[model samples]
Structures are given as structure tokens and as C-alpha cells.
Target: MNLTDATLILLLAERIHGTDEGVREAAKSVVKKIPRGKRDLIYNVINSPSPLELVRHVAQNLDT
Candidate 1:
């Protein structure tokens, strides 16, 4: 993924922590603008996040 998208996904992945206000706000802002087809990645990251898993999902979505 490109830098902007990668950055957005990384912040969104931080949502798994729940208590990080900055990350949550940044993620919320970007996630709302994410295309409908790719919203599931946000759910996956929040539910079962890992750096590798986030990268994998982001890369997979980039490919689409």
C-alpha cells in the first residue's frame, strides 16, 4: 500500500487497544472514508490485530 493508506490502516489497527484516544480519533476519521468493500479489514484489525495481519490485509486490499 501507499504511504497515506498504510498510515491510515496502521492507526486503525491501533483501535485494538481501545484506550488510545489519538489513535482512535485518527482511525475513526479515516475509517469512515474507506471504501465499503474494504471495511472488513478494519473489523479484523480491531478484533485480532497484529502488525503482520494488518500489513497482510492492507496489501490484500491494495491489490483489489
Candidate 2:
């Protein structure tokens, strides 16, 4: 995925957990590119499941 989408995913992951400083920084780098209205969407996508589940979900989507 592109940097914007990747950043969103990283943000989502970081929000779910307190670790992953690198991912958080990456998310910060692209945070401005994300639209304000879409914050909830990113949160929802990230918080919908556990991190492992989220990883699997992303992997599944990418497989298609």
C-alpha cells in the first residue's frame, strides 16, 4: 500500500497498543496527509480486533 494508507494502518496499530515507536513515528510523518474526517474510520479499522487479528485481516485483504 501507499504511504498514506500504511501510515493509517500504523496509527491504528499504535492506538491499539502503546509500543512500536517506529510505527508511531511513521504514522506521525504521514498524519497530515490523512483527512480529519477519516480519523474514526482509521480507529475503527484498527480497534476492531486484536493486533494479530488485524495483521491477519490485512494479510487476507492483500492476498486478494
Candidate 3:
């Protein structure tokens, strides 16, 4: 299925907090592939009030 960038970003951020190291690494790989132009979106997610600490960490580290 073709996921929108926002959806993919949320999912990947969650996966980055997964217990499985491989899954976390794979999520990080995809996150880094996001266009730098999406940095604003990533920051928005990072700053959202309800976002988990791990999710915020992942979003903050996005190369986008």
C-alpha cells in the first residue's frame, strides 16, 4: 500500500521505539530518506503535546 508521508513518518517514529533492533534500524533508514523539506512537519510532530518521548526523539533526529 502507498502511504502518505505523514502516515509513514508517524509509523516509522513509533517503530524506532520498538524492542526489535532490526525494526528500529529499518525505521531509521526510511526516516532518513524523507526529503529535507519535510523538516517542518517532523518538527511539528516532535513538538506535539501528546507525542511519546521516544517518538519525539525519533522525529527530532529525522534528517528531513
Compare the candidates by TM-score and give the number of the best one.
Answer: 1
lDDT of 1 by residue, 1-64 (tens): 3336835556455555434444444455565577766666554544453544454455568647
Clashes of 3: 0
1-64: candidate 2 lDDT, tens digit per residue: 4545864566466556645444444444554566776555345444454444444455467537
lDDT of 3: 0.50
**Which ten residues in a row are the worst by lDDT in model 1?**
17-26
User: TM-score of predicted model 2?
Assistant: 0.37
Off by over 4 Å in 3: 1-6, 9-31, 52-64
lDDT of candidate 3 over 5-30, digit per residue (tens): 65465656566654434334434444
What ranges in model 1 sit over 4 Å off? Answer: 1-19, 43-64
How close is every model to the real structure, measured as TM-score? 0.38, 0.37, 0.33
Q: What does candidate 1 score on TM?
A: 0.38
Taking all chains together, the TM-score of candidate 3 against the true structure is 0.33
Q: List candidate 2 stretches off by more than 4 Å.
A: 1-4, 7-19, 41-64
Ranking by lDDT: 1, 2, 3
